[model samples]
Each structure stands twice: as structure tokens, then as C-alpha cells.
Target: MKILVYNLKMNLDDTIYDLKKVTSKKIGVSERDFASFKIVKESIDARKKPHINIVYSVMVETDRKIRIPSKGDIRVLEDVLKKPFVYGSIKIRERPVVIGSGPAGLFASLILAQNGYKPLLLERGECVEKRTQIVNSFWAGGKLDEETNVQFGEGGAGTFSDGKLTTRINDKRSEMVLEEFYKSGAPEEILYKAKPHIGTDVLKKVVCNMRKRIIDLGGEVRFNAKVTDFLIKDGKIEGVKVNNYEEIHSQVVVLAIGHSARDTFEVLYNRGVKFVQKPFSIGVRIEHPQELINYAMYGDAAKHPRLGAADYQIFKKFSKRTVYSFCMCPGGVVVGAASEPETVLTNGMSEFARDRENANSALVVSVGPEDFENSHPLAGVEFQRRWERLAFQCGGRNYAAPVQRLGDFINGRVTRKLGSVKPSYTGKTEFSDLNYCLPPYVTDLLKKSIAFFDAKINGFGIEDAVLTGVETRTSSPVRILRDDNLEALDIRGLYPAGEGAGYAGGIVSAAVDGIRIAEKIMETYSNESL
Candidate 1:
């Protein structure tokens, strides 16, 4: 018999044995009666901070017949077993081509390869191993590798980010994705932790393992093979041109080019592919001492051994727009996430232990189609580029990021010197007026919202807290229009999937979307499609 219990609470000092004892008492059974037990979910109940508790949901399996408590939180476990996928009967002649090895493309190709559909995965950047070296060199004041830097790489932008796996979408495939991560060198805790994350350190290994598994299963992954052009014939995808020199023919193509693939978006738009300007956020990355953050969230019990680093999420509604914290990384550093030259974008990343000195998050404001006067589909792309370039100029035309003091930004004055909270940007940085890069409207709203957020999380708007300029790649600026079948509206066999196509946000949702697309292809086509 399998049983599940929710809302099981344990004190901060409780042990694993205490959890088993609680489970046995709740089910009116002896401790020895339990055969196996696993925590289905675990979350921190830090409402009172110092007296924090761990709330858990556990799945118990035992041979003994246990009494079901007549409470709402305890009951028989529901069947969350994934439904087996049924493949279509259509036959195909050529292998499918997946462009961009981000989470979306990786999962999509993994699914196809698992089902005997050999897929050719192409990434414009090098593998994670080589890509890491390139990114480090760039961070160390070396020339940025245009193709293999933080934004365009083997694992996509998320490779250099916090590697957060949390998403709001409630999908059964999410569990599958997490399980796969666990199987591919990720910590098993990610399978059951309430807010699971692999972090950049562990995530690199997991990504490499996933790639090896895909290749071992007969999928071919090629690095530095950028898809420059699509071979479209009468509204159907025929093949793709790589780096303007080589072409690979295929009836099916998965475009998971990521949110920073500006050039690819332009090429597709120029090729007459339909697109629409989408709303995205722009803002600066703010950093505070990790100890300050831990105290803010955990109070007197800050830095408790089991608690690790603390994180916060803040959202405020302004008259013209809403401000929110994006990609909040606890005990992390701000990274230079630029794909093109002469621009700077900020993102946050942490290691598996999250033992860094600072916490940072993107304080961004939402911008819609109305914000940019241009009605062109790619106008959002240009809007992002314009601000990015301005930020580049503000930072002395070098790779250094423009930064300001939170207090100075709110006071509408230029920052002149440093404070106790030093900036954690990986690349070089310069003190500058962030107002020079961001629009007046955005800066004004950020000032107001920072004040508001400070009330919620102490030290959020402190004078010494550092703010790094221009985090523009919050998401894709254009949506590659697709139909219910997940294919481009006018182009058959051309699937526009993932962030670059404006279909998903972050690593988990992108991977889930990728799995969904792959399933759709499997359900609609087979060997007979040829």
C-alpha cells in the first residue's frame, strides 16, 4: 500500500528518524511497519523566522495495512504515474534537425532520440567544457568569444545563471525533467525539494552527462554549427544552412535558439517568417551582502546549517507598470551576459553550495508593445539593443558594467564612490549614473519600488547596496508565431519552440515545452510520414 501525508511538520532540530516517527504516529502504525518512505515535498516554514519549521509531504509504502487518518492532509497517494506516450505511424526519410542546444532543444532531441528518431543537435557555441573556459577568460578581462560566451552556449544562458529549475507551470512532464536531471548527475534532492536548483557548478556536469547520453542513444550533437539559413520550399522546411557554408537536409526542424538569438530572429523575420513583438522586462541587477539577506529572511536564526542561503522575491505595482525581482540568486555573483559586442547585460549565478558573499536579483519593469512606437515585429529587439548600447557607452566602452549605489539611484544623483556592499559583477565594473542607460520612466519606477521593497526585506534599498546596469534579456522580444500543432503558422515542418520563440521562460519550462513538442511530433508522425 502506498500512502501520502501532507503538512507534516518537524522542528528545525528534528532528525530523519523523527520524520519516520511522525509518519508512523500519523498513520496509527508501528515504526517497524514502514517498508520504505520518501519525502515527496519539503518546504521551509519560516513564517516566524527564529522558530522555523520544516513542512513536508511524504510518500510511504508498507506491507502492513495502515489506518487512513480522517484528516484532509492524510490520504492515499494519487496516481501521478506518467501516461505512456503513443507514437504516430507516419514514416520519415531523414533525421530531424534541432537547432540550439538549450534546455528546449536538448530535451526535444533527447525525447526524439529515445524514441528511435535520430536527431542532429546543433549548437552555435562550444560544449560546456570549452564554453566554461571561454566565459572565464572573458570575465577575466579577455576578448569575449562572440559565439561561446554566456548567452550563446551549450546549455544556453541558463548554463551561466543560477541554474534554477523552479517554474510556475503545473505540468506532469516537470517531474520527468527533474528525474532526468537527477539521473544525469544532478543531486537526488532536486527530485523532491520544494524549490529545486542544480546551480551552475553541478548543472554543468548534468548538462554534459545529458549530452553524452543523447549521443550514446544515437543522437548526433555538433558544436559551433550555427543555423544561418533555412531551406524552405513552398512553405515547407527542406533543410538548414550552417555558418553560410554547409547545408543539412531534413523534413523536421526544432528551433530552440534561446532568448538572446537576435541574429537568428532577424534572419527568420527577413525570410518572411511571421513574428510579433512581445512584452519583456528591463532593469538592473542589485546586490547585497549574503549575510544581510540571510538575516532579512531568516532573522536571528540566520545561516543555520540546514537552511543554507536565504532568498527573497519582491513585486510592486506602479502607476504605469509593475516592478519585480527576476532570477534572484542567493549567495551568487552578477555575470556579464552579452552575446553581441559593445553591450552589457547582467545575470546572476551561484554554485551548488551557494556559499558566495552576496545575493543579487534583477529589479526589472515590464515593457509592452506600446512602449516602443515601432509596429515592426522586431522592434522590441531594437529597443533592447538601443538600451544595451547606451549602457555599454556609459560603462566607458569597455566590457565593464555600469553600476550605481541604490541610495544614489533613488536620490536621483550620480554615484561617485563605493560602499560596504561591493558589486559582485564577474566582469569589470565602473561607477556611473544608471540613469544614463535606463529610461527616465524606468529609473523613476525602480526608485519607488526599491523603497517599497526595502520595507519588506531589510537592507534592500541600503545606500551601499550595489546596482549593476542593463539586464535586458529578461526574455525573448519577439514571438515566432506557431499554430496548435506547434509548427510555424505558414511553414510546415518548422517548429518554433522555447524561449527564443517566446514560448517558454527559464530552464524548466523550456525543457517541459521541448518535451511537449517532441511528444506532439511523435504522436503525429512516424515512419509513414516519409
Candidate 2:
């Protein structure tokens, strides 16, 4: 039997030996009998400022069952069992088709291929190698490739972001997802750290390795194959037409497109796939000096090498809207994330070292279905495009994003020039009023929230702090409706799988959703049918 223990605490300076010795004494075993243990989870308790501590949850292999202590910071950890996949009798005439090479599509394809169901994975943009070059060109003031930018690529939108592995969902598959990432060249710390992040630099290599492994497992991955049309016969999926010409047949289709696939969404909507308008957030990217954030989060201990750069999250509710921070990237730069031409949007990214000059986050306000001009499912998409277009025009009608100083924006005045803190946006950025981009109410809420957040963390609303225009792609604007079987309501073989389908948010959750969909497909079909 394996005994799992929780809430093992140690000082920040303590070593693994200290943890083992403490665990042995607490579990009422000699050091020799304790043998060894693995850290299942670890987190830093920095709430007490200078006096920080490292907390752990560990599992030890043992032959005897251990008793839970009556009092102390220890308890038996619960085991999470995954839903077993039971093969069914349905005949799968062809290999499964997974659209989009994001976490969801890749993971679903990986599982299917590993189980003898070779899957075809298609990505609209180029592979990571080409995609990285194309994105770098855009960032370096070259022409933007509308189809192969940050938002639509091999690693999905996450390829250019912080690559945060944290998810709010408590599903057991998260562990599986993390383990897979670790195997694919992600740092081993991700398996145990609380708020683990791979960083944009490391995630690129990790996803590339994941793709290679999928191919090694007999799965096929094709890039630059955008699904332009779906072939449906009597409410069942027959195949998908890619790049407007080539049609690939498959019995099952996993729609795992990322959030910025506006054209694909329209194609799906026009094909009569059921969709519902979903609430999504939109606002501006706010940036400040990384040192300011570190000082605020760690005080005088901000310079400690062990702590690294600091990040923060703040939320506030006003009248009809709730404003909060999203994708807080410490020591990061704001990047251009527009998938469509003549539009400007911003996202944040950081490298593994996180040693950039600025820290940025999406300080956004939530907007729901009611905020849309109409009840049509695509209304939110149109609404998002409106602000994006306005931001484009505001930024001199180029791919550059319009930026303003925090104080100037709050004061209802246009920013004529930048101050101490220069904008770190990848594409061009010009000093301008952000009011030309966002809704009036959203601007008002952001102004109030900045002050609210400033109280929580000093220097958050500093006069020279930069605010970039329009971060509309927070999540999917419409949810492709799916039933309990994880298939589209009216379409039999269409599985609406990830963020683009409004079923997941970040990398880890999307991967879990993909695993669940793959398991469901496995539970409903068997290879014998082929």
C-alpha cells in the first residue's frame, strides 16, 4: 500500500533531507524504514512577506496502511481514479480526425494513436519551426501572416503566451497532462509546483517534442490545412474539406480549434452547428516595471534569487461588470495576437528566466451575452471585431496597438507621449487614447478598477504605467453546443472539444477536455470495426 501525506511544511532554506527526516518522524517510522518518498505537490507560502515557507504533499510507498494523526498538519491524500475507457461495438470505418494542433487536438490524437486508433491531426498554421520564424518576422516589423500568427499556430495561442499550466478545475487528468508535458521536455518542477508555468521559450520546444512523439506513435499531423467546410450526411459527419479543396473522410471529428479561429467559427455556424453566445472578457494590456511588482509581492526580499519574478491577481465588481486581471505575466512583454488582418490585439508572454524589463497582464472586464448588440450566437464575434478594428485605426491603421499612460487614461485625456515606462509591445505601439477602442462602460470600469488595484498593490496605477489597446480574445465568443456524449447536439460525430468550442480555458484544462473526449470516443467505439 502507498501512504499519501499532506501539509508537510518546511522553511524556505530547508533541503530535501530535512523534509525526509520530518516526514519519517511524523509518520512514526525510523529514517531507515521510511526509505524514500516523492513530492506529489509543493507550494510557497509567501503570504507572510519576509517569512516565507515551502509546503509539500508527498506520497511514500509502503506495505502497511498508515493511520491519520488526530492532530497536526497531515492527512491521508485521496486517490483520484480516472474513468475507465470501455471499448464499444460501434464501427469506426476510418481514422479519427482532429482539427487544430492545440493542447486538445494533440492530446486527443495522442491518446487515440496510442490505443491503436491512428488519428489525423490538422493545423491551420505552419509547424512550430516555421510558425516561430513567421511570428518573429511580424514582431520585427515585417508583414503579418494572417493565417500563421501568434493566435493560429502549432502550439495554439498559448505558444506565444506565458504557457501557464495552472487551471481552476480539479480534474484528475490535469496530472496526466502535466506528466505528459514533463515527458515532452517541460521542466520536472511543473509536476509538483503550485502555479507551474513552462514559459513561452520552453513551451515551444515541449510542443514540438509532443508533436514528434505523436508521429512516432503512428498519428499523422498536417500543417496549413485549414478546415473550410464540413461534409455532413443526414446529421452525421462524413469528412472535412481542408484549405477549400482537399476533403479527408473520417467517422469521428474533434473540433479543437483555438479561440481566435473567427473564420472557422463562421464556417461552422453557417453549416448549422448549434452555438450559443458565451460571456468573455475584453480590456487592455497593462504594464509596469517588473521590479515594482517584485517589490510589492516580496517587499525587501524581492531580490532573492530563489523567489524569481513576482506575479499578482486582482478582481473587483462594479455596478454591472466585474473587472479582473487575466494571464498575469511577470517579467514579460505584451505581444500582438491578431489572427485577422487590419486588426490589433495584445497578449502577454514571458521566457523561462522571466528577466524582462516589464510585467504585464490583461486587466479586463467581463462582458456577457446581454452586452452584445443582438442575441445571435455570432454577435459576440462581431462585437469583438468592432473594437479590434477601432484599435487598428487608433494605432495608425497598422498592426501597431494604441497605448496610453494609466494616469492619462484615468484622467480622460489622450496620451500625447510616453513617460518613464515605455511600452513593451512586440509590434509597433504609439501614444494615443484607448477610449477610441473599448466601450465607454468598459473604459469607466477599468479606470475605477486600476485605482482599486493600486490600493492592493502600490505603483500599479503609476502615472507612466502603460495600457495597450484591445485584448478581446480572452475566450471563445460562442460555445459550439455539445451533449452529454461530448458530441455536437445536432451533429453525431462532431465533438466540440476545447477553448474555441468554449469547453476549456487554458492549456491544462484543454488537454484534460481532450483526454475526456478521447476516452469517450474510445468508450463508444473499438478498432475491430475497422
Candidate 3:
């Protein structure tokens, strides 16, 4: 019960040698002491090499004889309690259903299953491993699989993304999400890194492990089971209609369909669900050699084995409009993420090993109400489609993403040659005018942002840094409205809980919101005696 903070370098193996120095200090150990109980929370710092600091939390216990618990005893206790599943209860109907196997739904299903609720999960896309195979096929030979692509799938769009775990949330549930991820096959190092990421390679296994646990705990996961309609009666959701045919009944439904669920949005809107257009970002995936970024961040230290490849995020305010780096993947490659037949979307992904030859990032501009020509939720989708169409055209009608050299883009002149940094896109690169793909204003803003961001990171605005076209799926452009209690504002059982709901930004916050929504459902049932 004594919580302690131990900031020790991560590689400490000799606990006795290390702790002896701390606990070796003796107090009066005569019969005068009757099991004196006190806990000390001391600050400790560990090292990677000599000066690099790695910190940890440790709990200690001491007795009256001033006798310290043997390191083995402490380790045993810590190990025993470390994975303890607290008795957090929610008396829902024996089974609830979760839509979308993204991080939000996955974590919610895990907790609900652990807490004795046999939740059912539905995912529109294929499993992560299968989805990876399909996505790579498209990346390799330009074959697009609409159902199993990066945007839709067991792991959601985050699977193909940088897997950025950094969130703006400072909540206990967020910490729990990180801890659970570490437990469910994510690298342990992600638990402490300042900007933690579970590279696309590891995220596949991590998601699969979470799915296994859900199944082991009596939950069911149905992949490629698209929920086409929310079956509501008396203005309360009764269940979801899958694939427009089969109906699965459930009193509670967690909709984490993710930002890219455009088809689902259309289906729900027709089913009487209300939504509104919202702001999201639009831009292109820019690919550069990993060495370029490594050189820029570390300079001569770029050759240091410890640093690996570097990633960066830069931003600029252009006349009240903001242009920023959205997803930066180190040692990553630009993957073709197109779902529709004639559209192309670009996303960045790094392997768990992160040993790829290229580095990539999304330099995006915010698209908002101004982009909406008329008042329609799907208007934003149309807007996205238009740009995607142009991007596809920019690529010479192939799956190769449209590419524009920075020197051509910013200098208002097209270049026909390559420079120090090479393009890593498997697709073809065309040095064409970006205006054909992006809005004139958007491309102009981007040109200004490049010069502005140059001061922050070198080699950023270089002539050779490649700009691949149309990274439009920054986030959902429509928010399925939800009330303060997390349920849909108009529909009681319809809980819009994650990125698609406009309630969360990235993986951690989305997962945390999912847990909150699940807990809220449990609370509702508890209050109603359901």
C-alpha cells in the first residue's frame, strides 16, 4: 500500500546492490521500535548510457526492526499485484455490442469482457493481419481492396497510421489504456516514451492479442460485419442491422466506426440518425529518405545507433489559418490508402522494427465551414472525393499517389530532377502542378508553411522533399452528435464514442473515451437496475 516513485535507469538488474544503498541506512532498531510503519516516496533517475534519465514507480515496505523486506519478497509482492484486475462492476444485460474493432471499441470490449459482460464486437474491415496483406498488395501492385484497406478494418485507420499514442488527455483511464496496450503485446518501451508509438508492425499483433482476450473472456468478434443501420424504436436504439439484412439485438451499442466510415455514415443518416458537417484537415503525404530526417535532427549524431530515424512535427499560422504536421512516421513508407474506386488517399506507416529506408509526414491544412458549398453532412465527403479524384488524376490515373517536388511547388516552377533526398513511394512520382489536386488557397498556404517550418527543421523545405498527394482523411468531417453522457444526443442507446464522434482526437483519447462511454452505460444500467 506504500506508493513510491523510483526514477532509476531502465537497465538496472542488481536490485540488492542498488537498494542496499538506499535501505542500508539504519534507524534505532532496539525494542523501542514497535513495527514503525512509514513510507518514503523518493525521486530516482536511471540512465540509458550515463546521463539519459529513465524513471519508474516502485513501492517499498519496511518493518520495526528496521529490517527491510528482501528484494525477492518485494519483487514477489510487486509481481503479484501488478496485473491485478480491480473489481469494477457494471450490471448490464448479459451481452452488449460494440461496433468497430478500432482502439476504442477494442479497449471497451476488453474491459467489458473482463468485468463479466459478454460484449459482441463488429468490425467492417478484415482482421489486422489480413488487412495488412491486402493493403500491401495494393501498395505493391496497385490493387485496391475496398473492404480491407487501411481506413476500414479490425484495427481502424490508426492501424495504418503512425500509431501515435501521445494524447492531450491527462486522465487515469488514459494511463490504463497505455498499460493495457503494453499488456496486450505492445512494446513495453511505449509505456514510458515521451511520444510513444506502437509501429504498424507491432500494432497488428497488439490488436490481435486484444481480440483474443475478448474472445477468451466470452466476447464475440465478427469481422467484415458492417452495421448498416441502427434499428431504433420509440426513438431508442433496439439493435443494429448488419449488412442491411441481418439484425442483432442489443440494448447498448458502442459506435466507434472511426473517421473513415463514410459508407456507414450514409447508411445511418438514411436510418434517421442526425449528423452535421465538421472541420477536418486536408493535405498530402510527403516522403523523404530517413537519412534526411536523421541528419536534420541529430546532425553528426545521425549515425548514432541509438537514435534510429527521427520524426518531427512543425506548424505555422497563416492569416488565422493553421498548417501543421499531422502524422510523422520515422523510418516509414508512404502507403496508398484508397477505398473508393477512382480516389487516392495517402497515409504513413512505420514497422515495429522501424528500419525502413524512408521517412514520411503529413503536412496538412485545416478545412472547415468555408469548404462546404452547401449545407449537407455528406458535402464534406464530396469535397474530399473531389480532391481525391484530382489526386488520382495527378498520379496519371494509377494508384501511384500524385507527387510534386517542393522546389516546384514553392518556387512556382516545376522541376524535372531529383535531389539529395529520394522518394520512397512505391508508386510513380510526377512533377506536376499541385493546384490541379489541391485548392489554390490550400496549396498557397502550404507553400508559405514550408518556408515557415524550414526554421524549425532543416532539409524540410529542400528542393527534393517529395509531396505525395491528397492526405485528406485527417479526421472525420461529420460528428455524429452525442450528449454530455456519451450517448447520441437524439438516440439513447446509440453511443458515439470515438474519433468518428468528434469526442476524441487520437488513439489514447479515443480509447479512453470508449472506456468512459462503456462505464457510462454501466452506470445507466446500475441506476436503472438493468
Candidate 4:
């Protein structure tokens, strides 16, 4: 087999010219060679203005070496016959319970159901479609659905988010997740784009379709089934208490609780689960025109139909700390994702069509104990609480987000009136200074970052650009220790897995961790650990 790599340009007629070359280059080739051409893998460089590249391998009719290549990095097709390291089947019998129907739980249950394990899936929130309705009601009428809002619902926080599949991790399972999303009815374009997003509108349908498949395969998903307490007998997990009301029995339970389950963390801690505080990020969602980001990324190719809107991930080293964008949404809307009653928090979401008013992203900075006084496991929760409380007061005691203009934020003043741009938030937004919510250090650093961004992308720091208050729930602020057996540190059968457990960041990493923990359960605790 011969493998080839092609450098892709982010320009119009880029791929078309490549296809033309392919046709011209294989004039005398047999039909078998033409059929053998396939793009097995593609990736973009981890650099500014990165190029899209493809990897493939070819095999002639006379070749006899069919054995899988290993022990080194090679072309993707060279390992076609190899066993999938993630996601085919686990070959187990004991049905497991998965708490929270977010990405972690959904992927885990999907694989388990395919492997003949009827997973009992419990969700604290409503399904995505229903959850969206509840969310809209809260935004429109200020009537909040405490149980099924943006954070606690069927798809977890990501369900209400931009449906961004981008992550910093370079694990191989990332490709598997992207492929699985496509198979579950996401747009096929997500497979090849430099910055792919399923968007909130499309993600709802994808999640419902996936849940239907799980049910068809004997898996059970119980909505409004919030886990309130853990049942531990003889120092091992027996079941869980739901809604502080119903007790269910199960031996193997996967803790796929999304990061918004702060109450669950406190419950687990009081119930003898060991944990330690970890540093996380907190900041505001920065909004700019979609055309600004596209021009920054594509240069003159900004108007290219094939390219669409471009995305940027600007990172900087600030006094031994790093600051960057976390959930960049293009052609997106700033959403009110406040799960709490009075506290105002904001996030960004786009549509599959990406036909929205404004573009937004989390322009967050790293927060450490230097800001929070205590090293307690719940310190992160407190840090988030302080800002959310301030934002609550700033947002007129309702769940309205405290918004500021970039010009006003940099000038250390409050914005008085709206300019040419209108905020995308459905909830009311008051023009105010954001210094009250963010720490002095954070605001100072943000000023510098906005300037850097303006220099990088023209009109990035325009006066009309909106800055939504306090996107604090970037990730878990504590690590629930787990040993190689995938059980909680020194605990018998309790598996603290996924993003809420502080072992993963995004959907891909969380799903990979879930699979790894499930495999550990199958290998060590199965009735017959084959």
C-alpha cells in the first residue's frame, strides 16, 4: 500500500482543484486503483491559520501483506483490520446504571446497549426538545424550570450549548466520537471541518435519535430521575436514592454526572467520597461580528462559500498563566444558562444553519486559590457562587445577564446604551461594568487580551461588541481520586468517571473515560472476568 498526504487550503476551489488533480494523475490506472483511493484520516496543524490535511494508503492487486502494522506512527489505512481500541463491544452481562444523560452517559450507554448490557439511564433534566422549551420559557417569561434548565437536563449543559465538538485533547478516540456523531445524524460536514459544531438546533435531533436507538436495544432512560444519594452497603455501592425519594438497586453504576451537578458533589463528599480541589477557568463570553473571525482566519477567503465562517482560538501566556477561548461559537447567540434562581450566568449557542445575530465565545482566564482563600474541595463552587451572586444583583435581581461593551470594559466604565449591535440573549441584559463580577486580576488581563484580539482580528474590540457576564462552569474544580482499577480511591465499587469527576474535559474525553471505566468494571468485577 502507498499512503499519500495532501495539504488542503481554506480557499474556494481548493478541494475541487485537488479532485481534478486526482482525476488527472490516475489516467492510466486500473479501476481497482481508482476504487482503492480513500481518505482514511484528516487533521489540522496545531498552529495559527492551520492547513487541512488528509492521509490515505493504497494497495495494489498483487500485494499479499495484509497483517496490521503497529509499534509506530503510520498511515490510517495500514491499520484497517486492527481491533478498535474504543467502542465496538465490551462482551459483558451485568447491566449497569448510568446517571445523567449527557454526552458521557449517552456514549457509554450507547456502547453498552450495543454490547447486550441494558443500561438504566437516569436523567435529572427533561429531553433536549422539551428542555429547550423550558429554557425558552425561562428566557421569555422569567419562569424557571429548576429541574430541567440548561445545566441539569437530558443532554447536560452541552445540549444547550453551541454543540461544539472541539477539544484540546489529541486522543485517537476523538475520531471515533466524530464518526459516531455523524452516524447518529449530525451533519457530515463535521467530519472534515477545521472547527466543527453540530449547533444547538441540530444537536437536539441527534440526541433524541440516539436515545431512540438505545431504547430499541433494551436500554431504559428515565427522565426527571435525579440521583439524590448513594446507597453504600458493606463499603461498596448498592444503588442510588433518586429525588431524595426512590431507591433503586444496581451493582455497577457509572457516574456520568455532568459538571453542573454541584449538589451531587456535596452529597457524595458527605457520603465518604474522597476529593481534592483543582484549578479551573472563569470569565465572560466575548461577542464580535462573525465576519471579523472569518477575515482573521481565512484572509481574503472570508467570502468563500465553502469556507463559511471561520473560528479562532487565541491563546496567550500571562505571567506564568495561560488564557484562551473555551467554547467558540460562530454565527451564534449568547444564551442565559443560569441554572440557579437569582444568579445570572451566560453561554453561547448556534444553529446548524448558523443563521444567528451575533458570534460569541468564552474569553476566560485561569482562576486559582490566589483568588479563592480556602483549599477545600468545594472552594471552586464558592468561587463560582461569589461571581454569580454579584451578577444576580447586577442583573436586576432576576436571571438577566450583566452585559458590557468591550470599549467600556477596557476603559473601566459602564456602558449606558446599546449601539449598532443588539445582544442575542433572550433574557434581559443591563449595560453595566463587569468588574464587580470578575476579579481585578482577571479584568486587567482581559483588557490586554481584548487589545491582542483586536490586533489579530480587525474590529474585534468594537464598542458595540457585547460581553456577557461570568461563564464560570468551564470544567470540574475538584478531582475525585480513582486508582488504576477505575474505582474511587480505596472505595470498593464506586466509579467516579467523566467530566464531573475531573478526569475529562469535553465529550470525546468524557466518552473515552466512560469506556475505560466500563472496561475496568468488566475486567475486574464481572462474574467471570475473562
TM-score of predicted structure 2? 0.97
**How would you encode candidate 2's per-residue C-alpha lDDT over 398-426 as one tens digit per residue?**
78889999989988788987888989998
Model 3 TM-score, all chains together: 0.84
lDDT agreement with native, every candidate = 0.90, 0.90, 0.76, 0.76
Using TM-score, give the best candidate's number.
1
| RMSD, every candidate, angstroms | 1.4, 1.7, 6.2, 4.2
- Cα lDDT of model 1 by residue, 111-203, tens digit: 998888888999999999999999999999999788999988899999998889899999989999999899899998898889999899999
lDDT of 1: 0.90
Kindly indicate the candidate among 2 and 4 with the higher lDDT: 2
Where does candidate 4 stray beyond 4 Å?
1-4, 8-11, 14-20, 23-32, 40-76, 80-94, 525-530
In terms of lDDT, the poorest run of 10 residues in model 1 is 521-530
Clash count of each predicted structure: 10, 0, 5, 0
In the range 224-260, model 4's lDDT, one tens digit per residue, is: 8999999987777888999888988877788889887
**Better by TM-score, candidate 3 or 1:** 1
Error of 3 at 55 (Å): 7.9
Report how far residue 128 has shifted in candidate 1, in Å: 0.7
